[model samples]
Target: MVTINLTLNNFSELPSLLDVFGCFGNDYEYTTRGLLRRKIPPVCFICSTLMVHNGYNPHTKEGPGEINIGR
Candidate 1:
């Protein structure tokens, strides 16, 4: 498994991380509250699971902290 600690100071860095993780199912954004938000798509089960396991909020698909990607 691969693990990465991603620090996204701006929105532009999101795409690269998604591509690296094959998590292109939904577009993600950071809320003003410093939470990561992503739309839950029907075909994004794997992505959602990955997010959840990484400490993202399952219900809101958002997390409060630095972004981390792992496999």
Candidate 2:
């Protein structure tokens, strides 16, 4: 068996990482040093962090084009 390791280079890479797991199905596993032993939220950390990075604030809905992503 061969094993591969992945290091998250940036928050922007989150979407690509998600695509990898979605395509891999049961072949992938989330193996952090000691994180897998505990119970994490069902929402998943990557998606939540990405949403915040994209300025998706639940409390503020200023307008349709209000988000300043600054890209």
Query: Which candidate achieves the best lDDT against the true structure?
Result: 1
lDDT of 1 by residue, 1-71 (tens): 32334556745776775566454333654445655545442333545344442344445445535776996
For candidate 1, which ten residues in a row score worst on lDDT?
48-57
Expressed as tens digits, the lDDT of each residue in 7-32 for candidate 2 is 66445666675665455434334555
State each model's CA lDDT, in order: 0.49, 0.42
Q: In terms of TM-score, how similar is model 2 to the real structure?
A: 0.24
Candidate achieving the largest TM-score: 2
Q: What is the TM-score of each candidate against the true structure?
A: 0.21, 0.24
Clashes of 1: 0
Off by over 4 Å in 2: 1-10, 34-71
Instruction: Score candidate 1 by lDDT.
Output: 0.49
Candidate 1, residue 41: Cα displacement in angstroms equals 6.7
